[model samples]
Target: MQYLPLFVKLTDKAVLIVGGGSVALRKAGTLLSAGARLTVVAPDFATEFLQWQQQGKAELIQGYFQPALLDGKLLVIAATDNDLVNAQVYDAASARNMLVNTVDDQPKCGFIFPSIIDRSPIVIAISSFGTAPVLARRLREKLEALLPQHLGPLAELVGRFRDNVKAKITGFAARRQFWETVFNSDVVRDVQANRLPQAEQKLTALLAEPQSLAGEVYIVGTGPGDPELLTLKALQLMQQADVVVYDYLVSPEIMELVRRDAERLCVGKKAGAHSVAQQDTNQLLIDLALSGKKVCRLKGGDPFIFGRGGEEIQALLPHNIAFQVVPGVTAAAGCAAYAGIPLTHRDYAQSVQFVTGHCRPDGSEPDWHSMSRTNQTLVIYMGLMKAAHIQQQLISAGRSSAVPVAIIENGTRREQRIITGTLSQLADLVTQHDVSSPALLVIGEVVSLQQDLHWFGQRAQAAVFAQPLTHIA
Candidate 1:
């Protein structure tokens, strides 16, 4: 914090630009955007400066800049080509204790222009204290990409409702919470989507409320491996999450999408190790929601599958807590898609089944006969340890040894790997490939289509069939 940041109200304020070159023109443009009453003092004026002067948009004094020229201006800028003249201008402004900027000269200036991302009411200013302009500009570019263009409109909406919100909610905490809810609600989202009438309707409903609404929990599925696979509702829930309890399997990229200010609690449970028990996690959500905090129980895959979402939901049900579930691209689907193996195909497979490899300690396998039928795909989750047993059981149940099997490791991740082989040799292939945990095993005739359908693996290769690539931004 080399300099205290501030947004000066320059409207109707007198500002002087003591040069008529490109540098001076840039400063004049910035001041005009700020609604400053600008005066350009120079011996000679540029063509654009003369045009502005003729239009009376700005006043131009066709004379050399002197110390006396700095008399009563609210702000001044010395952007002249002459270094000596800029030094004199700096001295004159310093004597009068006025705010002045000497272009490119930090030591002689009262203020420096920041590399700003202008969203008007939602302006973001980045500065390197005149140390690195290029770095500051690069940082501004990154911020520009992260911030939505409709933020300006969103800010204007807030400005319009501020007074009403203050008058409607009496308690400080309640008032603060009201605004938080408004920001996280569908009102702002609808506005961003260019649905103004819908946004206004939502605002009206909020205004009609007699009291602040109660907070609730959202069970969000952060899709396996890829952040982009998240649902729009899931993204919104994450943005509004006051506290997020995440599992170890949630990728860092997905977690980064969460609000930076939100509290993140690691309650991940490994195969045999538990950091926070299931009961404790359920209790945490209940406590947070009761305290009026938006809680998000972020899981790796779809909550209803192998995830313990049912138990958590049951716990909340007893406590009368309100919660919503946001579905994600489950690991089975993600691995299958990224590996170029469809779970179902008309000629080879007609149905798809998802099953966990681990059964209860009673040592009974889950209906192996039904699972080994032809024209069906079997996706085994957390089944790396029992690959040999699973393969033998399926064979014993009359399934062909020639059935295609594909193991996808870290599917959808940058380091994702896929190994394809026959069902009889899948255990040996898995051993040779050293497939790790967090992998999915897909067994069906669909695996044979990998050679032609493996689009994800060939992203770097040029296509023989020409098609225009769409730029996301």
Candidate 2:
């Protein structure tokens, strides 16, 4: 590590800044916010600095660089453009054993200001040791969006009750567990909703009871291949989980958002491939929660859709395990939007239906007659294996062989591929493109709209409809 990160309190502390330009003004604003008693030394001053001096926020000294200026200062910043003057300030501060920072000059800096995300009582400081400041700032921007805005107020509220909690809760473990419950409960919800009085009341009520550990399951739907599609509640529960039970369909980018230290157990299922049996996955969730572990049953797309989430949650019912279901952007919706093929357009199609091509254990087939209805969009999930069967069945059920169709592979992701053709050529299109699982099959007149409305994926493949079925292998 090039530098030891620290957060120092500068409230009412003496600090010196040796410049009057925009960069110096920027540093001055931050110091003032920290309540630092500042003295600035420069031959000339900016308008803002003169105004700040008049307001008694800082003391302005009109003079050249001097070693004596470092006297009795806690920290110093040399924001001057002149290299010689910046070096002079650094030497003077170094001789006096004071912390000094030379803006934009790493080797000369005894301390470097970091890109900070301030949530008042909560603050995050990020630095790259001046090697990649821009990268560090960009990272800070991303974090700023991810972190909730009410964190500071929440922290302050908890801080006020620290003494009371410490007095009531004997062991450190007990207090930590208590706080975790508070964070996971309606207390946090109330706080986030800005209902402070209700939040405080709930916190007090919670503290009045004995601290105990109870585990629950969060059935989160990590939307179709896009991490950004995850709901706020889903992300919150994911981070709070002690263990995450995921599947093959869930995107890796979505998995990365789960709690870093949380144990991950994959029960990934695909066509003809099961990493772990569905029954065993149910038992695993029950076992973990029974042992007082918070389990997150994460699934790709909407759990209630074609994801078979109902069967998993039903198993938990007998055990009386608590669970939450967070819905996600299902594959049909995600893929259609990304591909710019409206599932239900007023002119193209009035109705839309979602179905899975995987045959049932009982061998009963979906009503092909209804699914083959005209002017209706039909979206098939996991249809790659049965593409030929679907094409044959739809045509046999009075659906037109010339009906437009599209196979969207890895929909909504950067590697997404869209293959468009007629229903007669659905099987051929899949074979030619070597389409894989987790692909959505759109069959209807709406698929024809891809020619004019296709927005994402490789546009070079946009001319897919022009290719004749016989042209493909």
Question: Largest lDDT belongs to which candidate?
Answer: 2
What Cα-based lDDT does every candidate model obtain?
0.83, 0.88
Candidate 1 regions off by >4 Å?
1-31, 35-46, 51-119, 123-157, 160-176, 180-213, 361-363, 460-473
Clashes of each: 0, 0
| Per-residue C-alpha lDDT of model 1 across residues 165-257, encoded as one tens digit per residue | 878888654676687778879998898999988888898798787775476889988867677788999998898777899998788888999
lDDT of 2 by residue, 1-473 (tens): 99999999999999999998888999999999999999999989899999998999999999877888888899999999999999999998998888999999999888999999999899999999998999999999999999999998899999999999999987654576688878989988888999999999999999999766677898988878877778999999998888999998898888889888889999979877987988899899999988777899999899999887899899999999999999999999988877878999999899999999999889999899999999999999999999999999999999999999988887777567778889999998988888888789999998887777654333423343322121111
List runs of model 2 lying over 4 Å from the truth: 1-18, 32-78, 83-119, 124-154, 163-177, 180-205, 455-473
Name the 10 consecutive residues with the lowest summed lDDT in model 2: 464-473
Instruction: Find the candidate with the highest TM-score and give its number.
Output: 2
Model 2, C-alpha of 69: deviation from truth (Å): 9.5
